[model samples]
Target: MLSICLIFFYILLIISLTLFYFSMFFMFNDLVLFIEWDLVSLNSSSLVMTILLDWMSLLFMSFVLFISCMVILYSDEYMYGDLYMNRFIMLVLMFVLSMMLLIISPNLISILLGWDGLGLVSYCLVIYYQNVKSYNAGMLTALSNRIGDVALLMAIAWMLNYGSWNYVFYLESMKGHFEMQFISWMIVLAAMTKSAQIPFSSWLPAAMAAPTPVSALVHSSTLVTAGVYLLIRFNNLFINTNLSKLLLLFSVLTMFMAGLGANFEYDLKKIIALSTLSQLGLMMSILSLGYPNLAFFHLLTHALFKALLFMCAGSIIHNMKNNQDIRGMGAITLSMPLTTSCMNVANLALCGMPFLAGFYSKDLILEMISLDFLNILIYFLYFLSTGLTVCYTFRLIYFSMSGLSNSMSLNSISDEYYIMLKGMMGLLFLAIMGGSMLSWLIMVTPMMICLPFYMKMMALLVSIIGGYMGYEIFKYKLSWELFLLKNYFLSNFIGSMWFMPYLSTVGMNYYILNMSYKIIKTIDQGWNEYFGGQSIFYYSKNISLLNQMIQNNDLKVHFYLFVIFIILILMLMLI
Candidate 1:
């Protein structure tokens, strides 16, 4: 069955890659493939299934298919000898299908099919381990995502007022319609949850409880990108809008928060996961600033490199017998030189190193942001996040790939990892080359580039400083880290995601849990015990005792009854 799935992925990959060039030549304009159902109309609105095969969707689909195929192949080795390998593979395939569905559908109703499918299938994959941690993470992932699903549903309902469920028709034309403007906000909110923007970000890191392959695919490419893609498609509606301003605010915060969290995080997968969060923030913040194309460019490039990053992490984790903490890992480059080199490439790309895939989109986004109207705080955060990205990544490298050799001997290491290595090779190439190719293909109307030298080199400068800091902190054992010792609470606060997992999980449910406690106290314990069975039993027992006394025909009972009757007669006479 795994073999069959791999064959299917390979065929789809071939088909999508073929369409890549064809889509560029042919789909210069938006082409909607409509499968209309004239027989079904509601409130004079036409019901149709629509697929929009523009360059954007086609290119994104091709990339998704390519990465997904690699992920499937990687899973073959990572999941070797598992009891439910077939189930895992099918779930991944279904996940890819859902992503494809999401990519093609322009009609809101059609989108719901794919949107809901992505959420449901992701839940299954997150809980694949069938353990407590996996279960909790799955719930967080599903429920956080369900917010977007519900938001989309509401957006779909709102579009009914416009007499059509096809949102593609309304993107540009409906901007002047003040009443219809709320729909754009709804869509942004929906995008926020799906993209794991601030207040909705707890799930992304927690979701690392899933297998590394799922983490690579879902976190890097498909599931989280769904929201960003939706926003990219809906960019026309957000231009010059206040909602876009709000989106910019949240996305920047999210980027900074995730970068900050990554520096503090210890888990190897979580460091990558938080980095993914930070990149999503970068994408979201850029889209919020009205550069949807740049966001899309970054999104694609990010997918390529981030997927490679996760795959490298998986290779290391698998070889280390599942030890994921950086403290437990060292000298990975010694044992797995190929994997280490690939990991370094992916990390360098993420840092927007010269001419790499991430550099293309990331540099463009940062440059554009500098050109845009901005204040000090937002501007500072933008650069700070770039630095912190490098900070955490170099920190990761220093801990895992360099320093003291803590790993087992390097013998037989290269031979044992051929399958996983093969899978990563394809992604590694794309991570290196996909940026420049996609940049040329997608960005036809390039920005007018002009910047002072210091401004232009801002990203690079920060990256250099961040790298030095990471190396020094690990090498010298920084003083502030020890200051955290004096302030253990503060250390844990930042280290524990500012307690977001606690807050998102426990704080979100605080009110409902208290209400439940009240309900139990009032109904189940107090009212139920007194009135349901206890009261009835008490009265019945007393009556039975009275009956027993009467049936006994005791002399004392008769005397008391006669005395009570005489007293009543005397009282009546006195009245």
Candidate 2:
């Protein structure tokens, strides 16, 4: 029964994707009609020829669907025997539907609707375990997303009020307008929050409390990437504002900060969580530089490789009875040969090793950076981040699969868990060789100038050397003190930042409710004492005789009564 349902779901997904891609292709040729509707009428208009379909959207959609499909397949084994399996699968389907809607949406409203839907389903999946920790994580994710949603709403409101609601209208009307610049900056803020860029990024690492499949889905394809997709979709709006430079600065900060966090993280999932933030920063930097194609290309490649890596990590955890601490695992490579191989390839790809999907896409961004000095600074951050990625990836893999002791191998790893591992390996293979095959498709636009073959080769060499050196230096354990700098201020700051939201939330709730309760109680006591308790009844009784006298009708008496009644009514109203 489950198999039948899964098959039907996939069929619907494939059909929808096929139709959508075909429609997009036709749109590129100016052959598609814009369907506009009013309350009583429908209008169709022709579109102008566009280069939007050159490669970026196509490649991104392919990656989105591929990772999503693989995640679904892996979940079959990962969630096996779990009672909520069907419910889990449902959330996965809904997530995919939302992502597809987002990727194909032609305007900002549609994209935001899709984004909100994605957030809803992702929150459901994150808290699917229904435990306190999972609930906390889900709430944090929702709260952070609300910040982005509100920003988006404000930006949309401004655009509408300024007569630029529609994409075409906005493009036509926003000529040298300073308000548009402000609107663009707000949108960038929205993107940063959604992408889990720093200051707003703590939610992501906490989100590791979710299941591995949820982690894979988020880190690879859906929720986080939606922000980047939004940026690419609105690339023209961003080009004219300082928002681009702001995005670059934030991206660089997020990349380095996340790298530092990854280095200190002990839990395997948290390490990957931080790494996801770093990779997102890299993608945003490329996009900020107006290289949407390159950013999208890297986004796709990152999705494939990262999902594979996460799924592989999930399988290892499952085999080890849900253990996620790297320190607890060691020397399992000989026992879990297949899992080790998949993990190694994924780590290499993630570290941007030569000939992998990451190599082509990452180097493309670096090539763009070489054209300008500011870009070079951004690329330098990325280059340094590559070293951190290697350090963390190797730390994880080596701690899990390579060490010199039998004490580390308590339970033999299972081949039965290889279903997800095999799925990941399949993705790993594609990530390793897929870029060369897709190079022609990605290089069609003028933005994609070919780098010298030797330079590309040299870039590959540097990445490999960086990875190797990172492994050599950090393979053995080091003192925690080595990580602490200047009285451990920075680490303390990050830790506090992670906990600040929860602390502030609890503190604010207590303060407001407790303080309000005390103030109200004090007022009640004062009223009781002043009026001898039962204040309303006492007031009513005392005024009853006076009210009756005021209502009595006699010429001169009534005139005086009317004046008193008016004053009484005014006092009552004021009270």
Candidate 3:
């Protein structure tokens, strides 16, 4: 069974690679294939099943498939003895298919089909552990994503006014059309939920309860990026609108909040999840700034390193006896040298080290931000978030890999999982070289960034300072007293994601849950009791007694009832 799964992934990987190359060619030639099958048609209106084969969709599909192939390969070793391995593999394949459906469809209705598929499959995968924590996480994830699904449904309904559901044909003309702005708002709101921005942000970190492979595919490319991709497709429509500005605000805040939260986070997977959130905010902010192309570039580059990062984290966690706290893991490089090496590469790439996969796209994005005519506050937040990203990356590195040993003196920890290593090695190569290759391919004309020397060096400067701060901040992890005494409240505020999980979960639900409770008490247990079940029971009992009397030939009682009925009829007739 494992061999069959591996073979299946390998074939898909090869086909995806071929498609990617073909997409590059098609993109260079400015080619597109739009195939539409009309499912329903009326006077001047049509509902169609549309497949849009273009460079963007095909390229993204390639990345998703490649990462999925790698993740499944890694999972064989990570999930080796799990009884439900087959079920796990099937769920992942379904996720990939849904993502593909989302990628190629230009019709909103079909997009919703793909969108709902992602939500349902993700919930299943999140609860794969079948524990209380997993169940809660899965519900949070599903309900959060369902918001986006609803938005899509609304968008579909609104698009009915246009007499077509194919958004590809309408995105440009819809610009400046005030009446259609509702659809734009709906799309942005939907994207925000899927990407986990602001109030929706809590679910991303909470979703870490899922297995690491699911996290790798979800946080990296498929589930979370779905919204960003949708925005990219519709970017032209929302440009310069109030919706765009609002999106910019929320996205920047999300970036800052996630970066700050990662610094104080100890759970390895959650830290990485927060990092994914921060990166997502960056992509969204860029898209909001009307540079969907740059956002797409960062998206592709980010998928590679982020997926690699998760895989390495999974390998480390596995060797640590499933312990995920970085404090319990120190000097991991001494034993699992290869895995840690890959992790370090991923971290540096995330920090935007020059010539790495992240540097090409990230450096360009920072430079582009400097060139844009944004306010000082936006500028400050962007740089601050960049620094915090480095801070958390280093903090994670210090406690987990380079710091002193904190585990048991005698424990088995080594990079002996050859299958897992094989998977990491594939992504390690891409995380190193993908950025430059993608830059060469994606940008036909070189983006000449002109900025002063200091401004150009801002990203590097912030990263250096952030790395130093990361080491200093967490230097005394073993000493709880000093750390807690100095900055408990401050750290707690920032570390808890600014209490977003509370606001989104308990805060939002408190009123609604209370109302539901009142409804149950007043209806289900109150009015319903009298008018529903008990009334029926009483009437049925009396009717049965009457029938029994009639069957027993109770002549006196029957005579009295008949005389009363006849007298009533005669009195009515006389009146």
The Cα local distance difference test for each model comes to 0.86, 0.73, 0.91
Per-residue lDDT, model 1, residue 42, is 85
Model 3 segments more than 4 A misplaced: 38-47, 478-481, 485-487, 514-575
Best candidate, TM-score: 1
What TM-score goes with each of the models? 0.91, 0.80, 0.89
Write the residue-wise lDDT of candidate 3 on 52-86 in tens digits: 99899999999999999999898888999999888
lDDT of 3: 0.91
- Give a tens-digit lDDT track for model 2, residues 1-575: 55733574377548646754764565355453444433343365443221233234444665666677677778878888888888887888788778876776555666678788888988898898889999988988888888888887877777776643555456536746776776677778888888988668777887887789878988987899989988887788777457788888888888877876676666888888888998999998878888787777787778878888898789878877888888777777866788778778878888877788777787777666755557456666766776777777776776678875333435757656655765676587777886664554556454555667855454556566666765675564664436655448776656444444555356548788998888777776666566766776779887997878756776888777688999999999999
Model 2: how far is 501 from its true place, Å?
Answer: 6.2
Clashes (backbone N, CA, C under 3 Å), per candidate, total: 0, 0, 0
Model 1 ranges with Cα > 4 A deviation: 27-47, 408-412, 478-481, 522-524, 527-563, 568-575
For candidate 1, list the clashing residue pairs, or say none.
none
Residue 200 of candidate 1: its Cα lDDT?
92
The order of the candidates by TM-score, greatest first, is 1, 3, 2
Better of 1 and 2 by TM-score: 1
Q: Please give the distance, in angstroms, between residue 272's alpha carbon in candidate 2 and its true position after superposition.
A: 1.0
lDDT of 3 at 190: 92
Model 2 residue runs over 4 Å out of place are 1-58, 162-164, 172-175, 375-380, 405-409, 445-469, 478-491, 494-575
